[model samples]
Target: MAGNTEPLSPRAKLAVTAGKAAAAVSRAAGRGSGSVIGGRVALKLDPDLLARVAAHLDVVLVSATNGKTTTTRLIAEALRAAGPVVSNALGANMPAGITSALAGGSDARYGVIEVDEKYLAGVARDVDPKAIALLNLSRDQLDRAAETRMLAEKWREGLAGSKALIVANCDDPLIAWAASSSANVVWVAAGQEWKDDAWSCPSCGGVLQRRDDDWGCGDCGFRRPTPQWALSGDYVLDPHGAAWPIRLQLPGRANKSNATMSAAVAAAFGVAPQIGLERMWDVTAVAGRYDVVSFDNRDLRLLLAKNPAGWLETFSLIDPAPAPVVLSVNARGADGTDTSWLWDVDYTRLTGHPLFVVGDRKLDLAVRLEVAGQSFRVCENLDEAVAAAPAGRIEVIANYTAFQDLRRRVGN
Candidate 1:
């Protein structure tokens, strides 16, 4: 079914039908995936469609440089305890994708949306979301997103007059700065695993100093805000200092931090922290992230690594067994046209592991691996590469579009 059908004019109905048809045609022609074409077409026909649909809904928005999709998925899954939730779970996070999700799932009372870092402000202004979850910011899609500080300023300006409760990560300086303008804020010490993107203070351009666990800019007097909600040793600490263990199917400390943020956002909406954390424990995968698929008799644990921060986190998830590692990179629109960011990652961590580089940018990755003193073999065919790997369970790490393609290929 296509969203809530209760309050649509005949003209709007036609527009929706036309948009769905366009999406069908795109899928049939193999020209597009998910709601991208349909959403774009719908928005083209009626420019104000998203704002209209979002008006009646209680929306919780999640945005960050990384983990937007996974965090959004976690929040949506947690909120489903309240009621049916509408969301763009396919990792389509732009304006067009948001429109499609809202229009299609219009009947739902609650919406959980993952927004791109650059587009969060405008989308938040239009949707008037009830709660905004501000996760850590990092350098991603540099060619298109310009600078991280620029986006932070945009967020600060965008939320200046908003009435929504802001759930922000206190660990990230950029996110802390961005959410500072909000009148109502809930700080969460969702651990910042990657600090390379936030070395300088956004306020006074001072060098940010790292203490034992927190960061502070001595020159600017910008220090890490004491969080009302914090994660400590597999447990979430409340303002009262009571701790609750978070058990999730997703691996890594990153997912644990994501769960903590979701728990805080859920608490903002009157949902119990226990309910949120329990529900998040059931989320085994987001999009293709943290999913193990059987491809050509080889088990492929797919991890989506779009940028350096993501790569660093996902690299740790790889099992150090002799199982072959498959890396697929594509310079397609979704994966960012510039492949130079590949060099920024610490691929030296992948030193001893056997690597199979594949995708449009296979040569680029192969060269990077070689430069890192890592030996890798080039294989264009994914199925062939997986079949060739000497393993029972192999790891396949891919960037945006390449991950999507591999997911479908592996029968997801």
Candidate 2:
């Protein structure tokens, strides 16, 4: 559900007017790429504007290393079943984008915001959301974000003080440790497809022991918390052990985990899990992610992978043996200046798929693929790469900026 576009208060009206004007000016001048500048202008006009807007709405704040946008969308859609809801639709997860979203939908009673993993604590403090969904915490933007343990500790501290109901993924040890201290916590057994970032225990500097689904620390008593809303074998298991059917248009177990966690959040707001799952079926493509578009007589499915964990999860959702797959990589500010993370991804899985590499860091990916005994063709231009690709449905997996560039090419 979408919120009212009109602002209600004089101060909010002034801020929104200025922000919208700035956004229009930025778009006209081609200076601003997303909703960031408008948010910046609004916050500059009123430093406490986010707090003020939040005071009138029931907020649901979502934060994660990945899947924040999609999770936010799920929660927003579920909440819309009750009434109008506002959310950050673009891949913007910073304070400015959040403020812009809150301001844009001032008439809405529910605000579902996707805050950046690094900025979660600060935004959570101001928004005081009814429920905070803490998805998996993993290594992302190593140059920008702090260590995973440090972030978990920060979350632990933030959740310790907030009265909000914490809906967290218990599969990740870091996320479990982070939300362990929250008074009102609803743990979800959302599967952590990648555990590379949480090999060690965040508490007592001990090695976390894993035995199938359970995890514990021998050095300390800390362990994986039992989930209340658990997902087991394609069904959402409630606290009472009742199984509920879970289906989604979104592919992969990661998305199923996202939906399970969102179902818990929706339940907290009086929406039934069945209703949430039903709504989730309607959201196939989110912000150009997992979007299949017809281009140049070919069907191209777009997927964004910013880090090794993301790449690992996204690669499993595609089948590229028949057609050539486009792998785009860029080392821009948004994509992380360090493309060294490419080495962490398992390019060997792409051996069967004819690889067409593009972007500024295409050569780096090409070398990695070659090292993995995979053959690749480097094309500087995506159009040219597509032209050379096998005539069929192609999967184009790209990093942050590269994914956005491809989205623009597909007219998203």
- TM-score of each prediction: 0.95, 0.95
Error of 1 at 126 (Å): 1.2
User: Which lDDT values do the candidates have, in the order given?
Assistant: 0.86, 0.85
What value does the lDDT take at residue 152 in candidate 2? 94
Tens digit per residue, CA lDDT, model 1, 211-277: 8778999997998888999989799998888888999999998888898999999887777888888
Instruction: Give me the displacement of residue 384 in model 1, in angstroms.
Output: 3.5
Clashes, model 1: 2
Tell me the tens digit of each residue's lDDT in model 2 across 207-321. 9899898898999889989889887878888778778788888888888888888889998989988887888888888888998998888899999999999999988888857
Badly placed stretches (over 4 Å) of model 1 are 1-6, 30-34
Query: Root-mean-square deviation of each candidate, in angstroms?
Result: 2.5, 2.6
Residue 181 alpha-carbon offset, candidate 2, angstroms: 2.3
Off by over 4 Å in 2: 1-12, 30-34
